[model samples]
Target: MEPSKSEDIYKETKTAKVDDSHEFNEAEVKRLSNYLSTRVIEIVVGVSHKRTFYIHEGLLCYASEKFKIQLRGYFKEAQTGKIPDCQEDPELFAVFADFLYHDGWLRKRKSLYYSCEWVMVSRCYAMGERLGSKVFQRECLWKLQHSITLKKFTIANDALCRILKATTELPERTTGNEDPLRALVLRYAAGQISTLRKDPAFKELLDEHPELGCQILMRVTDDESDCQPSGAPPEKRFEDKVEFL
Candidate 1:
């Protein structure tokens, strides 16, 4: 017996949905297969007791154009299938590798403002900048800003100085351009200058990075509203704090 019209309609609809789902699955499988089929390269990080990471070339190149060119072009790294002299910290490189595979930073727990995790994230930001990975840099900045504003986490003077110094060494800084991380630091410092000034380390930071002093001064002069007491809620909205992001 022939099926009823309603039954035929339902069957057609279910078949179409199944076909669409199959197509989506096929696309995902193809993407995964491409990544897996690519050659694996050894990434040697750190100086002493160097930690090595075996990564697919396609995934690494997809995340960083610098690596793409270095590995694909006629560079020594391509011939050896290994990057033997990466100077970045092994722990930080682990974060980068995790991000490449997972699309997010892997942390055991949310870090406090004054924790060493802050410095780690800052270093990761600098490393991301060097690697030409904007996505990694953006995620790091977002994490920093989120902790500062929403968690009401105040950056320690030492951490601030470390971040400032790291950002200052980036290639963009040599070109006299203020990167987003540097700008965010200056903004936060300007907002909490009165409290930061009491710390001797803060004074030393200004001495070491005179340009930071000038920028903070300019920010304070331009927007006195950003000058909030230390540990107080930010005067500006979170969005205003990280306009670059």
Candidate 2:
């Protein structure tokens, strides 16, 4: 990424004062300005043909501790001003950048482009997990929760496959009992269990990856009290209260 004149806009320090009551303080403005600036480190991602994203060192260091160590620590990337050969999909990395800059673009895009947005969020979450950025993971999980809770988002078949594969392939984390991304995906599938099961591609995917089937079954089993099969008759719960005076 080439340097642009806009780089000057982000030179403000954290203590820079606000000009107006409605305007943001220097920190917020500087962050946004830095996101827009072309003069900064270039992290080239992807294979065969590479794609570059221009990001400020300060913004990276501030938002991600991994980036802080990699860029400012004794790592070679710190001196080279380049983060090359990132293993994440270029498209997913782009989405990750948007998450960092636009501050979780998923919320805005979720309703407008449901399936695609969910896919991006899932991919971004996987990328975040791989990159060791809890901030990104939390943001992605937050979007997933909102989307699932609202029950309005659609997830693409290929996206689901990607997510499933990503989760299943992820090495077990010593810090937690289960992968959060897997749990989130299972919960999401449980929300629309019938629709997902009915999809031929989904069925084939489950067949190919029995681990996913196990996850779906586990999700259904765990939430069995709350999630009833579509055709099952509704069971009403009656509560009788007896108060002793």
Candidate 3:
């Protein structure tokens, strides 16, 4: 096959034809090839009848740690202007595939790019909780575009809100940004802070105050308390309350 044809084949195999994400740096092309191998091997084993659904605990940890380093390094370096042209880079999506193809943590193929898209927008959604924020963003976009055409404001809104939040023309961590709630979300998503919900300064937010508490979530699981109804009675628990008896 001609070199051009091979390149076309490679691009097609990745489902990577979004005009926005077609520019490939050589370093990135190599990086994605390796990650795709990881995804393919794990998937083949998953489909094999001979294989039990047990995780390779040791390998899992090793992979997770390695991927974290790669993931963080990729983005951290981006802070220095080395960032990939996110909306147009297939490599950005590969970085996300590293997390979503986890042997167990993920089961949905629909929004394979959801986490990446989410991460790209705000960085406050879950950070690396369920999946890395960037990974979640891409998955959402990919799934939404593939599955339906219902305007998907919720999906687009989610990505829009975060990305808009994450982008600060000039950022100030002390005062929070002018758009503090969005800033808060970025910090949480970037893993700079633990949880947006629990930040002490969150109590200080005057405008979008309620949203601060809503974003608090556990680090390990990324589980959070956002769905509590607005008019629902305040939770009645007696954890550390003082008794007036």
Candidate 4:
């Protein structure tokens, strides 16, 4: 027996109900976005140029582990409902705020140059590392990997110095758990070896932080033998390899 025309029409009209749990619903997204943008809490960041940011507690706490614990835990700030003297750079935090709300900073600026943006991103990664925000840290890595392209390597002297300084200072623990940012910087510097070598600031950076030179060498040469300092012990080889690179 054939199915009725009425039954076929009913089946056609009964479209599959979407699983909005994973999908973005415009109305719901708009409502939540508005809430996040309302700015209920004040965060004071920076030293010389102290900047106070008005942000939503929910959005902030959700994105940052430091804020989540500080705002919600049994702390004085929790009772007072005020985040004071955060000691973060306002400029860096601004980029972080963009990430928290929009999941990225790319949408905010259309004509922003990579040199300018990567500096901000490097700072954000530093902030994330300090705050123990794995989410923000991961996002920073993703953004850098996706956005950074091989060009003439036009980062400002100050920014390049800062990046070099930041990468060198990261502490080493047990095996592979080093600061990932350090590796990213090494790769970047390797790609721009020619330009970076000519820069006086970069030379000064190497003089100040000699380990960065090793990192550059390690990244430039793919083979361990090429980077290996003479007579380095077998056991210490991997440790030294990661130490520089």
* Per-candidate clashes, comma-separated: 0, 0, 32, 0
Q: For residues 103-181, could you state the per-residue lDDT of candidate 3 as single tens digits?
A: 2222233332464554443342222222223334333333323322222323333343345333432233575433333
Ranking by lDDT: 1, 4, 2, 3
Error of 1 at 159 (Å): 1.8
lDDT of 1 by residue, 1-245 (tens): 24434234323333231111112233343254456577899998887768999998877766665666567665677778898877668999898998766534422124345657778888898888667677677667767665665546667777776776666655545666567676766777777788877878878877876777787777774553232223422222111122245
lDDT of 2 by residue, 23-61 (tens): 334545443553445237888777766788888765566
- For residue 182, model 2's alpha carbon misses the true position, in angstroms, by 1.7
Q: Between the candidate structures 1 and 2, which one is better when assessed by lDDT? A: 1
The superposed Cα distance between candidate 2 and the true structure at residue 51, in angstroms, equals 1.0
TM-score leader: 1
Rate residue 66 of model 4 by lDDT. 64
TM-score of model 4 vs. true structure: 0.66
Candidate closest to the true structure, highest lDDT: 1
The lDDT of each candidate is 0.65, 0.60, 0.32, 0.60
Give per-model TM-scores. Answer: 0.71, 0.66, 0.21, 0.66
In model 1, what lDDT does residue 43 have? 91
RMSD of 4: 20.4
TM-score of candidate 1 on Cα atoms, chains taken together: 0.71
Give me the overall lDDT of model 1: 0.65
Q: Comparing 1 and 2 by TM-score, which wins?
A: 1
User: lDDT tens digits, residues 44-111, model 4?
Assistant: 87777888887787666555656666665556666676777776778888878766655345332223
